[model samples]
Target: METAFTPFQSLAGGALIGVASVLLMGLMGRIMGATGVLAGLLMPANLADWSWRAAVVAGMVSGPIAVMLVTGEFPQVQVPVSSTMLVIGGLIVGVGVTFGAGCTSGHGVCGMARLSPRSIAATLTFMLATGVTVYVLRHVMGG
Candidate 1:
């Protein structure tokens, strides 16, 4: 069988994520969503409203790098599809993030923690959309 993450490792990762989320919300009053972060960076107009976005983005980009340095074992990344498929999937995700008002990290973690109704709705939409997409790709499209 293929090697998989140990239970303790999974728990540690989850705990780290939870701690980081709490710290971000408590300190910066911001939701750690990569899509929104990147969008804000590209626009730069929104940077005036929030000064810490740069640091937040930097932390996100650096976290994995730091982990890699410590562990010395990079996770395997598999891309089973073509660049066109990847681009299409990315565009769809972007559209969903915009329409839902937040991505998975924002709604699934932070908003859910805060008991936000909009976040609940957005999270559900994201899940449903993901399920449908997977079903279509695997069964209907046979990809």
Candidate 2:
């Protein structure tokens, strides 16, 4: 499958992520790790913790609606894989996050920004694994 080259969209999204990360850190002293945020929402320690996680999740879910309102239509998404593959990929990601202790938003953006050695290593590993996975899937498996 071919990947879409969306430089402007990518830049905008990255800027938004960076701004959100800084805001979350400044406001809550927390990293804007998507998986951690979701997990906290699912199994919160208290009502206060749950509330912030819920707000963050709500903002995440409503982004598409906000985009639709702005552009008069939802942003187009292209998922070339089957539903089965999507589910499998999600499961793999969940497993990876559990093992790696954080996701890309956390390790790559926030953690690396702070010069955390663990995050740097994790980010490098993530990129390398991603490259290898894509190569294997596209070139070797022809998927």
Candidate 3:
């Protein structure tokens, strides 16, 4: 399957992510690692921490709502795979995150911005794995 080249949209989205992460770091002095945020939400250290985490999560879940308010329609999403495949993929990601200590949003975005060595390594590994996965799925496995 051919991938669509959405440079503008991708740039805008990436900029938003960078701004949000920078704002979070600047205002709260916290790195905006999504998985870390979610985990903190699950068991917060205190009320202040919980409130911020809740707000971050709220913003995350309300993204489509914000788009609908601005564009007058919810963003369209497409999922080509079955629910089982999605679940399997999620499980695989969970295992990877557990072993890697954080997700791409954390390492790729926040960690790299901080010039963290571990994050740099993790991001490289993530990129390499993604390229290999895509190559195998598209060419080797003929998916």
Winning candidate number (lDDT): 2
lDDT of 2 by residue, 23-95 (tens): 9999999899999999999999999999999998998899999989999999998888799989999999999
Whole-model lDDT, candidate 3? 0.93
Off by over 4 Å in 3: none
What is the total number of backbone clashes in candidate 1? 0
lDDT agreement with native, every candidate: 0.79, 0.95, 0.93
Candidate 1 lDDT by residue in tens digits, 43-79? 7676454456777777767866777898997655667
Residue 47, candidate 2: how far off, in angstroms?
0.9
Models sorted by lDDT, best on top: 2, 3, 1
- Residue-by-residue lDDT tens digits, candidate 3, 107-142: 999999989999999999999999999999999999
Worst 10 residues of 3 by lDDT: 1-10
TM-score of 3: 0.95
